[model samples]
Target: MLKAAGMLGAEMSTTRVLLALLLTSAGLRRSSQEEIAEQQDSSLITSLLETYSAVQMPNNGSMPLRVSILISVSNVMDVDILQYTISSVLMLNQSWYDYRLRWNETQYPHHSITVPLETVWTPSFSIREAHTVETKDLSPKVKLHSSGWVQHILGLRVDSNCNFELFRYPEDDTDCQLTFSSLLDTELAFEVSYVNEIENVKHEYLVTTLDARTSHGPGPPSFSLTLHLQHTPSKTVLSLIVPSFAVLIADVFGFMLPILGNERISYKVTLLLGYLVFHSSLVNGLPGSSSCNPLLIHLFLSILTLLFISMIETIFVTRIASEDLPSWMSRILWTHYTPGNQNTGDDGKRIEAEEDRVTEPRSAQEMEQRRQKLAAGLDRGFTIVYVSFLLLFYAGFAGTWFLMECHTEARPRPRPGF
Candidate 1:
């Protein structure tokens, strides 16, 4: 009975000591409220100075920091140097910096404290696939939350590389990728994870075809956020295709002009020159890549060839008109223009219907008939050849362009690299 009584007294004393320690700690915490609140305004210079001090413990990711990141893309810019520029804000929930300034939630009441990100423990992080430039904006102030969440609103316009194929350009869709990863922190020192399962983007211009976060690591871990942006090609279609078709229409109509004089040649030359100017301007605006055949480039070349051939044909036909043709050759070519037989109430212009020039006629009337027939035959032949060639060319070009656009092609993905 006495031994049992002693054991009970020892247990009661242990409970009393624990209660006293708790009360004392609480009192000390209350006394340090002002000091705790002051931690938010801690000088970055001071932090940097003390960063190298020995704490008798190594700090190279010894305690793996759990970093949950969320990205909200606000703007997507143009493609330059085969890269897509993006603007976004980041929210990072880091447990390392949160508890360092812990205090009563009711007193200071600031849930978020703004601080330079490097002052806190560095995570395994970087925007992978970002275009390397001389001046990168990495000094963003991450707002640290009392609950260990940090939010940073930065406009680091990242130009991520995207592959473009131009075989079916102006009617093709472009897919761009945006990947965020960390390279400095080993997987052991930092756990990089996404706050949201899917990437969040502003849906104004580009369509979000794929939004995913991926990580494959047991060693040096990396968190990747990949988003595929699909281009509708509206701008190119409206700017390039429409204007080019208009010029093509004008060129086609030039074939209708009577080829009696220099009108047809002048029209073709002017049309070809206009297209050359247009092509040069278009080339200046297009991405300077030769991955695939550009639609405009092909069409421009075809038009140039046709115009050159038209000029050659024009010169050939003019020479034929000026030169004399054989009486039989002219007769055969102008069979439709033959006069009906005279002495049967025929008009003065209609002398006689010679039976396909059975023998070469040397009469003055026959000579005049042959000369007139030659001019008409040459003009008519030029008209038929020009129209036929253009029509056939149009059909072939249309078929090839249609096939280029309709063929099944694998959607391009941005290749990940430095």
Candidate 2:
């Protein structure tokens, strides 16, 4: 019985040790699996990070592998024209960011990316003549840069379809400019054409023009260009011709007013002069360019001609009034309603000599009446001319405006490739 109990205790000890060993082996296997899984997870995370890491930029001419963190410029402010904040990275080499990046992302990542950016300022661009804008003045507002800078590159796009002119001085030799506050895209170029946008602010871009306020500047006075994305290049001949015709009509009537010596001559001259001055101011408001905006030339010519005609007519009328008329009537002339035989003094002829006249001053009265009648007719003719000219002018204006409205039609378009 003792031997049996001893053997049983030994067996129990062996079994207990075996059971402990089995549990230990299982635990070790689980640990090994957990370690492998951790390694794989680590590798996956590293790959992801590396794949989407910050962009790389060429330094001057050399390529350096550096960590760059991209930070989306959430809201671009006015102060950013000078400088703005960038992402903080432990790496010193990654601190420098390049501004020449093309930002293309619907939802930019808020996190900082690891990429270098470059800022570059390009030279001024040349603006040619023959550019036409809806208005003479360009808006002062401009957008130098846009937000959502994902990688190191920030695309600077400048589009111009309005304000095709720059007012250059005689001494200025440099061309007009379109500059950015930050940097510019030297690889890219500029394009401009006629577009019909009412707002000059819609085409906000990073191009700059000369500011003529400076003394002896490089180019003419520069105005900010407003792009009209919604407008297209299309205009009617009538739109180009109507304003000119209106000015011409007003000019023609200006001549007749003074010619008739009408009392309202001053009023007519004033009205016509006002139109001429207003149109002149309007033309001068536009930028100076070699291109012929037909309307402008037409307005200038018409106004000048009208003024000339007015002055000439005034002189002519004055001369006419100063001229001497026949002595049949001194100031006024009246008709002598008498039988033919009444004046038959000697020769039985229905004639009366000056000496044999009735001496009633009828001839003078008649002459005066005739002169009054002529003056009245002249006044009436002037009035008619004035009214006719006005009607024609307004008619042309209305027609031109209507045609412009009809000609200006908007059509949808695909996005332009930058």
Candidate 3:
């Protein structure tokens, strides 16, 4: 029994020791497993910190954004819309980077981009308002610059709508002064087309630069204009020449009066003086030098010539009217003796008949009648000759003046330097 108990105690003590060692080993294994897990967690945390540090981001919480610019211009403003578009891009730093080029199949490389923009500026006004401008007027011009990218351009779109009134008749008291404001885009390429209802006209202009403002940077823009007058026929100094020549035609008609009377002589002299007055006045009004206007000089000389002819005719008519022929001479030419009527002019009988025979009273009457007819015929002949000369002079003078004017036009004139 004793031997059996001793063996049991030894087995129990060995089991107890084995149990303690097993507990110690199990505790060490658990602690080691916990440490390994902690190490793995630390390495993961370090990796996460490294990843966050690699990315650079602004911490102020502001969003990344680019600058956007806007530009616009009026289609019908007074300034040129074109000049503002001319620009050169300045590269601030070129040494740090190499440029990359992308091209299409056409072999055109993409060094620059041309942005196409669809923008329109149109004048907004009614036909009634435009027409109502009347003496008041509104004109606009447009210009554009072809050298800038459409997208990057920035400028103001100015729509300058204004009205001005001018007096149609110079005698009228109305006068107007106009002030033009700035244009839409001070810097851009633009063009202008305008409709003037009041003027019943259309205007177009290239907007170059502006005026009215005195400054330096991109000077003020302006709309220059040239007005075209219509071809409505007007009576100028040129058209008056024909009517002036007609005044002398009246003098020609006055010469047809009977030459045997004092009345006719006075009329002829009076008409000649009137022509002299008119001719002198005309010469004063005309240019002193030779003129391209043909009839001017010809009319001057022809009238003076006509005056001379008239004065001569007057002197001849006056002398003839005052003359008295001898009675014996006249009776001899006029007497027509019928066998019974040829009576003697004495106190009695044929003593008078001897005197009458020499006097020839019937012959005298016939001769006087013949003289009157000859005088009239001579007057008509003189008038026809005077008018013929006038027409011939006019034709020759016109041809010569025209040739001279054309000659002057053909040669080039030297430029004036001094």
Highest TM-score: give the candidate number: 1
| Clashing pairs counted in every model | 1, 38, 50
Q: Runs in model 3 with CA error above 4 Å?
A: 1-243, 290-295, 321-357, 360-367, 397-418
**TM-score result, candidate 3:** 0.33
Ranking by TM-score: 1, 2, 3
Candidate 1 residue spans exceeding 4 A from truth: 1-65, 81-115, 132-155, 188-210, 217-220, 230-239, 288-290, 323-399, 405-418
Model 1 clash tally, residue pairs = 1
Candidate 3 or 1, higher TM-score = 1
Q: Which number leads on lDDT?
A: 1
TM-score between candidate 2 and the true structure: 0.35
Q: How accurate is candidate 3 locally (lDDT)?
A: 0.38
TM-scores, one per candidate: 0.60, 0.35, 0.33
Model 3 RMSD in Å is 29.4
Candidate 2 Cα outliers beyond 4 Å, as residue runs: 1-150, 153-226, 229-280, 287-360, 400-418
Full candidate order by lDDT, most accurate first? 1, 3, 2
Candidate 2 on 1-418: residue-level lDDT in tens?
9999999999999999999999999999999988886675455334433444233322333432122322221111121101111111110111232344223233332223332122222122222211211211133111112232322222222222222221111111122222221112122222212122122332222222212111122333222222211211122123433554565566555544433345436655665676667666555543343442323444356555655555455544443343354455323323443223245456545345533478446644544455556555655565576557657865775565335321112222222221
